[model samples]
Target: MYRVWNFVTNYSLLLICGALIALVWANIDAHSYHQVVEYPLAFNNWVGVDAGYWLKKYGADYGVTEVSTLKVLSFHYLVNDVLMAFFFAIAAKEVWEAVVLRDGALRGRKAATPLFATVGGMVGPISVYLGLAYFLGSETYDAVVRGWAIPTATDIAFSYLVGRLVFGAGHPAVRFLLLLAIADDAAGLIILAIFYPSGELAPEWLLLSVGAAVAIYVLFNRLPQRLDRGKQDRPNSTWVRKKLSFWPYLIAGALSWYGFQESGIHPALGLLPIVLTIPHADRSFGIFAEAEQHLTDLLNHIEHILKHPVEIVLFFFGLLNAGVEFSSIGSPTWLVLAGLLIGKPFGVLLFGWFAAHPMRLGLPQDMRTVDLFVVGCVSAIGFTVSLFIASVAFDSSTMLGDIPVQDAAKMGALFSFAAAILSVIAGKVTRVQKQNG
Candidate 1:
């Protein structure tokens, strides 16, 4: 019973269940689903005006007047923009730890192999998407070109889950996939920040965001030292110090999020900059290395506290965004499917082979080319981040005629389940071949 409970509550299982429930609920009664998602959670109308007046005053400045109003917060906004900020923060921390920490995938000269594989993973999908778009002629090309990054994402939970099922626990291939996914996530964040802006650039807000991130870094590093210097012997001193240490980062993250939003960039991108600013522990200690004198590393602390919350956030994120009408599938659907299913594996294999040979990077000793190929297939499952990009790439208000395109993209994201099945089959085949040999 305990094992069953553990399995059910596991992060990947929870995400899958959430996505499944959303699909069933949406299909059973899409009207209610839409109504619930679109329902407004109104804030105080302090100025005592309708939504339109606020839109007219501040909306044009941001170029989102047609899409949003300040009068209320919809459930979609709550999940995607606000709640998902923490999700992105977690992702940012993982990326930072991997690249900057001593025990990370990029820590040593040979350890950097996965980084190159990540580049191939991203490049393969994007190149395939663009090539397909070009061959499909001008109209199809224009419609699908904006979503070139959609197939490049690897849903960490889903891909890891499938990889584990195929390769078993503690396999080197699984570790490779995890590192590749982390790199893919970093790339996805960069694409989101560069390609998806809400409106006209607000340079002033961008500057403020950068300044806020810098200040948070200074405070995160210095706060514990200042506290320890004064009161080491006090009762509950450790607890008090821990509690106080967290607030500056919390406040700073919120400030930076707002600044990014005001800057016309997606606020989730704000977490990336803030994450980079956090002090990393020495590489000698390990990935979750503690700070000197028992001071908590801010990045590790944030990840620990927010781990469960981020899982919950992912559930709500899937529930709010994963609902898709199957009947609405079209070109965008096929394009995304082709890019992820075909492009992802090809890129990973081609680039991975090159990196191992010409680049003189090392692959895990036990991992065969077949194992790498299976991992490549597993990496094709692009769900969460892909859906987020689809939402951003095809706005209904801006492209009323292209509403179907957005829905098709959603359908493609849902098709990642097929990729998971393929990975399992590939894994079984490899296992059989090994046994026969």
Candidate 2:
């Protein structure tokens, strides 16, 4: 009963927030939504406190006098390409802590978390998206490269927040859930790197980016084991320790971003070097190996400082930019809405449990099936990455002859947001009922 209340409180708020955003966007047109009524429509009001300013600024900054077509495209590219790289870097840091830095919760979930997460992650979106694609003779939208981003992402902040509430202190499986989310994040990054917008860029630049990436990877794999500076356990040379500061990585990452940008790749793949270069050497980590062990706290420290900001930005970016005015909201497009929020939870729940069943992998020891349902709800919160993927998949260029793909991405994200809300409500209500019972 207590568990139910916990889930409801944690899961329900996100849904409510999403609903408010969607309602405001779907119902109101762009400029009208920006206009603050009763404020007497002052110039400051028009040009301040909202996307209205930037939307106009981008129009001028990009040299597009008209806000009709190219302005939105410029805004879309700026937000998705530039702002999102920071978001992705933060995600990569989480992954770094999980897979390489050895975060504790991640350690606990190590056994089957990655596998189930990978599978559950794959099935839900493909099923929902492809099913729709088959139906309309074409699920033709723009920013098609963006589609891959949705399925691969898991909102770790929201998930972990729910996890703490649901699992309290004892359940080791929370860690596993954390790891699974990490894995989901990695998959999303791969999908973005491979599938996001690319065009005919100078092959030489593309090759340079690829080469740099490979070189960085090589250095990462070998460098970790060899660093012997301060007091790292395995052993390493003293000199390598000094070099681990942030610059070389910044340089490599910056260069890589340039190459990728020139090469026609999404350009954000440049964030990888920063991840590769985090100093893994821990003289203080030896305490964990002894009778009284504790690497977890230290891992948490590194993860928090390096990783948390990115997720925060990702969420903030979505709220600020991805939101649509829901003034005209209603049917016809509800299937896409249903597919994202509704079908997503259903398909993932079915498949996730199915993956668990044969192995008799009951819910995470302390978790109820309903808790799993809530997890499914959280999975449906695809905001940050979904917006990114939508932008990528439906290239800003792939306009439907006249309908701009950027607007289509904005619309798709709106639907995805709604879908997340519905799924959250389902979970929240069920949880609340169980709590009351």
Candidate 3:
């Protein structure tokens, strides 16, 4: 049991394995698999009836009924945005938790400059959008700009896996990887909350949600210090202590789900709220006080339950949202995919490299700063988050050739994902960083 936990903690490959399995499942079954991840309304408010009426009107001349159109669009949005929130939260929680635990390793280092990498990450994707937007007319650009923040964000698992393969453990790249990734994520989330909220805002409801989060934070703050002492004081029964302590973070996460959904930001931001609820593992106990030991044990237990599902759900949701007619990849897709794959690294490397040098924020002694750009390139793997942005950015009513904005989103995500994978693998195979070094 300890060995299993140790492996999952050291690397999240197991989580990725689960994600691949789920993606395959979603593709095989399609519609039914899509439903389990579905969350149509923020407050469980209904949209199907009115949405059907409008979608039907839009597709009527083309013989596509509004009902079918609305069904597809709504399902796509819910799966990508609503479901992917949990994925983001779980990824965010793991990376953030690791950074918090690794003691002073990055407190003063230039490699610790997550903010600089974050800036480059943000600039890279939006730069892609701005460049693409030039080809688009004005009205189209405004809607898409909301989603510009999407392409910049990176999943911790994806970024870290690449880092491990590229940097090798002898390098201090691990610390830099955690800082920059978390900072980049935090920057993206902040932008999303501000720019990408639901067009419809219920201020009173959002306020209530904020109140709920503050209250949760306060309540947990009041929890017993060194939970081990509390455990030793009572509960002679280990089973009782084990069961209750194990799920604090998961329960906290679900509550955060409800809160963020109500709070106007996408509900996926709920992951951070849940992360806040997870107390730092009380590692101070060399004594291994049963209570602190249990808390440590509890994290080991809860991490699997909460974390594995995130990858599985996101990967499958991505496949559902991303599977485009490969037949369409010829002109537009190849161009778009090329930009994300090629252009992103160019911008990120150029920008991150320049930024690191002026500030003397050198790369890990073992890592060439050029590798930072590689991380940035991988960060461009924006499938889950980017698709969510597309849902909010494009209109189902808006036209793009034979497809709607939602369809364009699906295409873009698949292209970006494919590009990210190929480029990163290519970076590895060619020793791009090594050549640069």
* Each model's total of backbone clashes: 1, 30, 5
Worst 10 residues of 1 by lDDT: 284-293
User: At residue 40, what lDDT does model 2 achieve?
Assistant: 19
TM-score of 3: 0.70
Between prediction 1 and prediction 3, the one with superior lDDT is 1
Ranking by TM-score: 1, 3, 2
**Whole-model lDDT per candidate:** 0.73, 0.49, 0.53
lDDT of 2: 0.49
Model 1 C-alpha lDDT per residue in residues 126-213, reported as the tens digit of each score: 8888898789888878877888989999987667767767776557787788778878888898889988985567868887778888
The model with the greatest TM-score is 1
Candidate 3 lDDT over residue span 1-437, tens digit each: 24323433433444344345545665576445544434233222332213554344434433444242323334545555456766666555544544554432223465335556666666666677667765666655654444455466555545554555555433455446656666766666676777776535554555544554566555543334334355665433244336556444456556666556555666657566556545555332211123323544444355556555665565456445554333333333333444456556666676667666886666656566666656666665655455556556555456545545455554665556564466557567647533211
Candidate 1 structure lDDT? 0.73
TM-score winner between candidates 2 and 3: 3
* Candidate 2 regions with alpha-carbon error over 4 angstroms: 1-79, 101-110, 139-152, 162-176, 201-207, 210-244, 281-316, 323-336, 360-363, 368-371, 396-437
| lDDT per residue as tens, model 2, 364-424 | 5555555545555556555456556654565334544445555454565455545445544
**After best superposition, candidate 1 residue 193: deviation in angstroms?**
0.9
Model 3 ranges off by over 4 Å = 1-83, 98-107, 135-143, 166-178, 226-243, 246-255, 282-300, 327-339, 417-437
